[model samples]
Target: MMRHLDPTRLPTLHLSRGLVVAGLLGGVATASGIALTTTSGWLIVRADEQPQIMLLLTAIVAVRTFGLARPVFRYWERLRSHDVALRDLAERRTGTYAALVPLTPARLGARGRTDVLTGVVDDLTDVVEASVRVTVPAIAALVAGVGAAALTALVDPRVGLVLAAMLLATAVVAILADRLESRSQAAVLAARAEVARVVQLTTEQADELRVIGGTGSAHDWLRAAHVRLRASVARQSRGRSLSAAAVLVITGASTLACAALASTSGADAPVRALLVLAPVATGEALGVLTDATRALARARACARRLVELLGRTPAVVDHPEVEPPSRRPRGAWDPLRRTAHAERGTQGHPLRPHGTPRLELRDLAAGWLPGRTDLGPLDLTIEPGERVAITGPNGSGKSTLLAVLARHLDPTAGRYTVDDTDVTHAPLADVRRLVAVVDDEPHVLAGTLRANLALAAPDADDQVLVDSLRRAGLGTWLDGLEHGLDSRLGTGGLGISGGERTRLAIARAIASARPVVLLDEPVAHLDHPTAEVVIADLLQGAGERSVIMVTHHHVGLDRMDRVVTMQEGVPSHGQERVPG
Candidate 1:
């Protein structure tokens, strides 16, 4: 179980430190209280008709010291423990989000709804609460209880034996109850997850449900899920209450047993012993049992959920021995190195002329999923100073082919060469530096406009950004905005139109100044004239740079050096190229 759950993977270092501090403080407070209670009990017992004031003074001093220390220590312990719990929850939440980044839409879609939300939020919070609120306190109580029992035993074996037996019974009961509770808790969590999934699915398909007139069916499904969840929660609550009640009963019985044992010892034995030992032992035992049971249940639940999340393997794995290709000087090597090399000598080609194609795809077969092939095992080449238009019907795999060239998805079979280097084996970062892709829906972060543009090229100056925006036909739009470059844009503020957002995305891609630029439907939302102007600007602005554009519009098709049409997942060409 520990191997599967791997608690070490949890981001709990700071939380652990706080819990340790709280535990230590609690231990000190508990030890002091037990020592005071014992000392006071023994003194009152020894006091006879000729009682000395000094004895009373000593007892009073011990009691006063314990009273002063207990509350202060307990307060600090509670504060620190809660601090640890909250901080741990925050850290786990952050780590879960970070983990989701690399997994993308795939892993998230596979996970059950309740599992993702609860594991990242509720279950992680429970783990921290279990450690600090339950586990640490239980440990402190056990330490104090054991010490008190030993002291009592040394004074009177009968009293000590009674205390020890009662504690053992309580521990056994708690362990058994915890086992039962954990099973119920796991069921409750699973049920809750099912409910969440059903709710999420309903919300996501709200339009479909309305269109199909199946709202009533969706409501029935959600109601059933909620009923199951409530039933599970009720069972878990019953288990916890039952365990708590059993602990209380056993504690009361233990107190009675201690009192009876003390009575048989002697009439001379002090009543103060009963007062101190009975309450302290009972309280400590109950505290320990209650906390231990809660901790055990919560820990088990959290561990199981975390295990499910971290168990998944990444879809793509990098080869350990792969090395990045050396960066060539910008203007030194011909941009179309592969074409130049092919035209010259196939073997040991040297001194290729400039103005050659920068990127080439040789018999590249690619797909989004495993079995359904999108693009070809077909040959294609783009030379420097060339603008190629890739026009096709929707679902014709234009974006998929562009994605392969951008190295976003690996080809099912075939090779993509960049500057005569096989990009399939090259580091992703290296490939990204050579190619820039602008998508239809650009992700605008919650920040100033300047910050959003800076994401693509961090060091781009205001002038460069403005120039790129002007070239993309966004300069006049920016001029009318209140904040200009500093305008806030994202979910809540300074809403930009869809066409303007696309233009800004183009500006961002152009800011990178990479040799290869790929755009997917960049002008889809723009009017006819505006789109034509933007397309013309893009083709002209990208002079000496290889550009592959996926579009349905034919407004500027005459300007392109070549037009390739894809039909039924195969390229039907205007440019003469065959599968190599």
Candidate 2:
């Protein structure tokens, strides 16, 4: 049940455990019931004279015990089977999420992540329910049916033959219906993915949809997807119903045939009469076949999806050759050490002045998808103790370039280096450790502010966090809040303003104290004065660390060490100047 175990291995374990438990409980219950029924029938037939009271009492007690144990065994089997199913589902859910971690925004887009979420949470629940409530019960029923038929064969071979034939016919019908249902379910899955895509599109375009009066179009798309899903469900339902009905009819006919055969054979005794009805018990067991078949089909489909997800290659692979810095400094170096250590300090050293450019990208071409380039194959570099501004119009690949430099996206062409080491081929974790990026749209987990900040640097002290927040202009905001850093941020921090969220994101980035930082329009949503203060703090606090700020506003450019203008798909011009 471990998350990292192979997907193909889980089902075998699940099945083995389920079968062993179910078989033990079911076999004992069936054997006891058959023995009681056979003994009672034989006693009544042989007792021509009045039977002894003790014999009657014994038979009654045996029958009562068998009847009581039936439900107990049934419940035990169901409980054990469910336990196995849930454990297997837990393993599948873990494996699916682990596989998705490295494929985000690439093999799996934002929309695809939503699909995976649905699959991991909702679809996985369905698979578990079907396995426990449907598959295992059906298996138990089949075993009971075969045992019943074999017991009857001991009494009357003709009756046993009829029951076996009926059971076989039902099995075949179940298999055919399962095929039909499988096809319908596959269609349903496709429709569900389409629905997810439409929902995501609608969410992303909520502002546009409200402005352009296109809400109805989104609704229509959703309606169409639902219709397709319903159609598939209807087809599956009809197939299963028909299969169940056929099974019922075959069972009834076999039972009736057994009765006629008993009557014609001149078995005039009550015991013999009861023997003829044994086929009815076997027939009843066939009723669960349809549910079993459907559950198996669903389980098979879920298994396939889980396998595919687990098999996907990670977008970024961290090589084992690279290692973290051995002696990371705690605070910025003195001015003399800063000058002497400029380029050499940028390579492996963690603590340097905040304003230095320790990371640089030159002629970089990168995108989420490999080989298909998006950003630039243009030259750019960041020097120690410098802040560089990157400007471009909307959709001009500003964010893409930042993501590339952050090592979230690998360059398709050209070179990107950190402290003179080519980063495109470097370990991803190493690149991440050297640089921290704060984007316009920040992700806030469902936890306290302190917890969220701690995610960036687990070992950061309270004073360090407070200092970073003050620098990001969030100190007053935190004081105004009820719990200060302990205040709980709801899911994605929904209650906070865009500006406040940006500040919190900045606080998180600064808390990391990396040598290189990337800010994507960090102050775009801030009010003028507050924006000015935060910008001043960012430029000042950057100290000797390298900083890249991507923005359209020209608020802090005059103070930057360099301003780089991006046009079309390349860096058109850059001016290196001293701060006024």
Candidate 3:
């Protein structure tokens, strides 16, 4: 199977028929510029010879025609080039997003995932921008330069030789500039990321830094980042400066050489003047080489980063030899064997799907890093509708265990199965669809309450949403809302308390109707009473679904069916148990 599902690759500045047409349009625009300059020179010298009115009429018309064609063709070039580039940009972004979905959260990194994602976006912009900046300009320069050389050769071969030499010198200058730019591109990108990281960290944690008396430390970080940024920019500028200066010098020398050669040749005064100005006009057309090479360097750097990111093997992959059986085996107890009251659902409300697939983990050792088992060489089983609480000290792998159980991290050793089949062969999406995760910092997006809940179940009706919110301990809150489901929450809208946020997340999970709900410190930010209330509501709300709560504190352990504690990577199940 392909590592990334998307077949379309990232867009690079490559030669294709669409690019050829765009380049041709750009060539016409650039050629018109050179023609305008040389034709004007011809008209000036010929007009000075006291020529007849009809003789000057064609020259004058030619000058006007070339001048007008320059801008018109240039505009057409811009339209064609931008259209092709933008279409490629859309395809690349879509393909990249699809490729990234399977590598999310775990394969991205252990931390700073937001930064990684932001970098991907910025890199993509640079890659697409290259089509306009580098490819078109480079092709335009080549077309115009070669046309000027060939036309001049027809008039005087010696002067044309001078133009060709100037082109060679310009090519050398471009090569130098490209080397310089490529050398500094990585440093510049690194400096930019560093500056962004420092700024983001300082702004997001300003209060904490101040409280810890580390404000000066944060400032030092920013200052150092800025220093690196300035250095990197200076390095990048050297290439452009060298290319620009070299182009001017080459143009001046070629003009002088053409003047010497053209004067000695037996050409007409008008033709001689045109040849002398040809070098200067070609130089102007090729001046964009400096900027073009710089863009190429930047695009190359971005493409490398993108390739490295998109090419990695996913953290988890499914290779199921056969489809998993639909029928679930009998666990320690039946998931459907709930109390009559629980069976009736919440206050005569209809029960959502009980996603109670049996889960078995045997000697499942896993970790974020290789050769470092943070979680288990342990065994556990979760029956349907089983509520289990996992409590552990920091670094004892409570969260790591949850990550493995949720299929975000693959086990390094032993076997994990849903129902009776090993998850290694199970389809990743199918397994993940049965699970919902609720963490401490639930994102309450800036939208209506209905929109927020609909993120979990887009096809769910309003009545089902209301029932979900009520079951997740938002019954009172929902009753008080004037607009009901349409009430907006999050930034720029109504702010919610920590408990409400936690409950909202639970509501989303409830709405998803996944059989397994993993809570990673869901009540970590709440006070004791609110935390207890949230836990009570969660246990009451979970209708015949497996609930696994990972907590640093034992606030709601008594409410769970079984409380398992982990110490130094070993799990010790407590005797305390409650009826389902």
Which number leads on lDDT? 3
For candidate 1, lDDT tens digit of each residue in 163-258? 777678778778878787878887877887788888878886887899999999999999999999999988888877887777777767777777
**In model 3, which runs have C-alpha deviations exceeding 4 angstroms?**
1-11, 44-55, 265-273, 323-354, 379-383, 386-391, 439-511, 521-545, 551-565, 571-580
In order, the Cα lDDT scores of the candidates are 0.69, 0.69, 0.83
Flag the better candidate by TM-score, 2 or 3: 3
- Ranking by TM-score, best first? 3, 2, 1
- 1-580: candidate 3 lDDT, tens digit per residue: 2233232355457776777788888998999999999999999999999879899999899999999999999998999988888887787777788878777656776325456768988898889889889888888888888988898898888888888898899989988998999999999998988888898889868888999999999999999999999999997887678789999999999999899988889889999999989999999998898888888899989988787777777888867563333433544343223232243344424334443678899988998877888888878888877889888788888888888888988999999988777777766766777788998778788899999999886867787788889999999999999889999897777888889989999998887766689999999878899999999998788777789999988788888988888976768555346665
| Clashing residue pairs found in predicted model 1 | 336-356, 336-357, 357-383, 363-377, 364-376
For candidate 2, lDDT tens digit of each residue in 390-483?
A: 8878766777878777777677778877656777545566566667788766877789888889978687777777777877778788778887
In model 2, how many backbone clashes occur? 17
Task: Write the number of the candidate with greater TM-score, choosing between 1 and 3.
Answer: 3
Which sections of candidate 2 miss by over 4 Å? 1-14, 26-67, 109-111, 120-135, 264-284, 306-310, 318-357, 368-371, 383-394, 435-567, 572-580
Please state the error at residue 17 of candidate 2 in Å.
Answer: 3.9
- Give the Cα error of residue 266 in candidate 3, in Å: 5.7
Model 2 lDDT on a 0 to 1 scale: 0.69
